[model samples]
Target chain A: MRTFSAVYCEWFKLDEKRYLDEVKRSANSHSPFIYPTMELLNENLDNFINHQEETVISFSQLTQYLVMKLAHENELKVLLDGQGADELLVGYDYMTGYYLNQQLRSLNLKSFFEELLTVIKRKNVEGLQLLSYHFSPNFLRKKILYRNKKYLSNRLNNIISQDNFYLSPMYKSKSLTTALIVNVDYKLEKLLR
Target chain B: MTFGIETRVPFLDFRLVVYLLSLPDEYKYKKGTTKRILRDALNEYLPELVKQRKDKIGFASPDFKLLKELDEKHWS
Candidate 1:
């Protein structure tokens, strides 16, 4: 059920992304609705679309926000997006980091871990997932997720299982799969549901 | 709604580049690649579960296959 919702959500999300790219527009498209709330929603959408027009964020306002975050609310919800930070951050898949560590064995593992940490701290959950993969290179030998099986729950695991990881039943085993199902109580049903 | 803007990218610093390049290849690109330093830096926070990531996977949504069955049973 969760996977189904995520899929259904993702398809529309992807379709929206494509439709936006084709139109070079932001969310909500150009639809006008009769409800006042819908009209306000449209206007807010327009604000975001307009903001995309000015991609650069200058330092003057940045310092203000930084100072504000520093001062208030234990900085719990401080969203840390910055301008053109991608030049420094790779923001690539975690497997890339794993491949890099494997391929570039000569580098100082300590310092490399530093750079990866900075990125993980800055991004969202997907970033966290990749960070997980980077830590355990040998774990991918089996289709089964490791102990605890939290993020790699059956739904997320099954989505990833669609790939040809060449994972064996050994190593982690279906025990991991079964544990995830018992804990989460969700699995992808066949089309016959 | 009120909005504010700010920008500074220490990453783009010319001095940072020169400083990075000044490091030995053993430190800069240990196996002869860029970003070789990140692995060591992030090793601690790196999740153990992900260390098993040997393959690249794309996300496909939950069993919409059930949708086909639902159609067959109800909407068909």
Candidate 2:
């Protein structure tokens, strides 16, 4: 239940006072806030790169590494985070834009899917290319049937017997379903990597 | 896993993820607000200031600035 935060100096202006104050206020009852200085972070990153023989690491990766190090040093064996919420909830502005654009053209599923495909290709984010297939109802149906042959075969009987099952709202809209599926696929690939 | 400290994401919990994914697009993002559902759900618990904050700085660091300074100092 402990919370750890890395605070930057005022010169950075990245950590606003309001956000930091809120973070401090929300700390768990017994949790201590750990603030690692920029110099310490730099040293840690340098040491990590030298030890691992890596030339570069992303800012996010570096931050995670430092947080993990701090947790290990503090003897905190486990920590809970709020990751993956962004992907699931469309927290990214770009994702929101994509979803809204798709919704606007919901009347024509084909053109909507085509436009989405074009956008995905233009953006060229990983695992997005696979998303195009899901947009095509025919392709998705075939893929699902092939991939879940046993499940599909028993779906008829299960549907008849399972009275408590609830269909997700995502299934009602093709665009939303595609967006969620694509996001999940992209996140899964990132996690695997 | 690199530092031997295990980090679990509760947001990625199976049931929670399913429910969140099922929400309408507007619930997720509306107008200019992102994570609308999360903000609303935590509004009562979180400070009003925090709830109203709009900035989303993800893993931002000043190391780049430091590096630039060092480069300039050395070159100059």
Candidate 3:
């Protein structure tokens, strides 16, 4: 499937901007999913979007990966993964655990090991990296930072269904947008042909 | 693709962008993430049965309950 993927590389390029925008905006913003893998996906998106107009394969390592993925599966779908600094070190899972527990922030996230994940990646807040020391469980400031009641609420409501008491007119506008994106991308794409 | 690849998405239809983008950015983020809007939307589309469903079966638990009667010398 190397040739198949290669044949579609240009198509991937054409759609890359829309896909990249969605992936980055979704992956970068606070959510319940792992970021590093999302990040790796984002980086591959760079080969499509950065517009440097250079070779897609810049080094021997990438060439070897493509070749191996092609020969083994005859389909190049062997799951090229970043493996782990997260699972091994527990980063993405931390943020997810926090996000889940945020529904009831009184519930703690320190005691589960179902999924291996990394820390909540830091993003620039004005200019500061807001999450640099966020994972230290016992650090007072870090604890206060990562466990903020405000952020916890946001992350919880982001993933879980609402209790319906709070579904106001304002909520409908936002819901319409998400509903619109999902239907357009996943449903309508199938029906168009 | 042979027809010069002119593509158009209906939901992302220009008329839609004109209406939505002109609205407030406040609709995007709140407290921390986009959950409020998303949940409200899902509640509308998914049936109440689906919206209320929450049961998952898993085997990832520690096996002590199953292993309590197993012989330690079995491997030998």
Off by over 4 Å in 2: A26-38, A50-57, A107-177, A189-193, B70-76
TM-score of chain A of each: 0.26, 0.53, 0.18
Best by DockQ: 2
Global lDDT for candidate 1? 0.33
| Cα deviation of A138, candidate 2, in Å | 24
The residue ranges of model 3 lying beyond 4 angstroms of the native Cα positions read: A1-193, B2-8, B35-39, B46-76
Please give, for residues A1-193, the per-residue lDDT of candidate 1 as tens digits: 0000011233333212232232222222332211112223233444454643542112222223323323232323232333222222222233224323432254657755664554455443343443344455665523223333242357655555543243322212222222222222211121001
Ranking by TM-score: 2, 1, 3
| lDDT, ranked from best to worst | 2, 1, 3
Docking quality class, candidate 2: acceptable
Q: Write the per-residue lDDT of candidate 2 for residues B5-28, one digit (tens) a residue.
A: 677778777788788878777797
Candidate 1, after superposition: displacement of residue B7 in Å? Answer: 5.7
Instruction: Give the TM-score, chain B only, in order for the candidates.
Output: 0.38, 0.73, 0.35
RMSD of each: 19.4, 13.3, 20.0
Residues A63-131, candidate 2, lDDT per residue (tens digit)? Answer: 667767777878888788777877777655345435544555556566546545544544533224234
Q: Determine the backbone clash count of candidate 2.
A: 0
